[model samples]
Target: MADGGVDEDEKPVGELFGRLIDESKAYAKAELGLAKVTAEAKAQAAKKPALLGIAAFLFLQAAVVVLCITLALALATLIGPLAGGLIATIVALGIAAGLGLMAKKALESGQ
Candidate 1:
């Protein structure tokens, strides 16, 4: 009883530490599982919107192609076919370059 004795009603230090460790491990595992489930649910919710966005992007690309073709055909009536195509291509390239530069600047500005 003189050598730092434990009381009869109290648990030993080693047993208490082991129980604490076990509970901590269980709590960590449960939290990780919950996080995984929550991430899966969020991804599932985003799927439809993501698909719709891709569809819209494709449609917009098709529209841009049609518009370019129409412009070339209309210009062909005034000029020759090859010249009209060349002019339309040059214009499209210039516009694309300007847009690219704008995007680059926006990215550099972090906006």
Candidate 2:
């Protein structure tokens, strides 16, 4: 201590600012680490739903294939096998085209 009991290492301005800058740097680093951990946790939480979405997409594709086969077989009981397959393909293509047109119209209207 100095004669007035002030700490000898204390400077009026320079020491205070230096400590402030150091603390600011440390706080910034800690905040960045916290943000990284938070992002990782959020990503982990979303992983299961992401995987389930992919599984659902795969299952839907399999179901569509099975349904198409069943449709063709049912038609074949009435029409011949060749005509049934052709009719099924044409119907599927027409339905897909109709769906595409509807989607385009909906998007345009939304905009």
Candidate 3:
């Protein structure tokens, strides 16, 4: 106390408190940076298997598509006489359109 009141030249107690706050912020920033790095590593680990699963699913879809094509061809042959030649033509056109759409989808997917 100076002259029964706060000192004029003496530093405010808030300055020291401000410095402590700054140091705490710096520490928090460093800890956040570390957490970001660790989270990225964990995300990479998690993504690997999920990506693999997607690839596997895509491959399976392709295989099923191939099987579908074979079955369609076989059915087209069998159904030709039973449904008549005109009906067979319509079916063939439908199959061709379906195949065109499938190809379009494949191209769009780049797979």
TM-score of every model versus the real structure = 0.87, 0.71, 0.53
Score each candidate by Cα lDDT: 0.92, 0.90, 0.80
| lDDT order of candidates, top first | 1, 2, 3
Steric clash pairs (candidate 2): none
Q: Tens digits of per-residue lDDT for model 3 on 25-98? A: 99999999999999999999999899999999999979866766665666668875445545545665788899
List the RMSD of every prediction in angstroms: 4.3, 3.6, 9.3
**Model 1, C-alpha of 102: deviation from truth (Å):** 0.9
What root-mean-square deviation over C-alphas does model 2 reach? 3.6
lDDT of 3 at 16: 68
Supply candidate 3's per-residue lDDT for 5.
86
Query: Which model scores highest in lDDT?
Result: 1
lDDT of 2 by residue, 7-110 (tens): 86765688789889999999999999999999999999999999999999999989987887888888999997888888888888898999999999999999
Q: Name the lDDT value of residue 11 in candidate 1.
A: 68
Better of 1 and 2 by lDDT: 1
Tens digits of per-residue lDDT for model 1, 1-111: 334586644868888899999999999999999999999999999999999999999999999889889889989999988899988899899999999999999999999
Clash pairs detected, candidate 3:
none
Candidate 2 overall lDDT versus native: 0.90
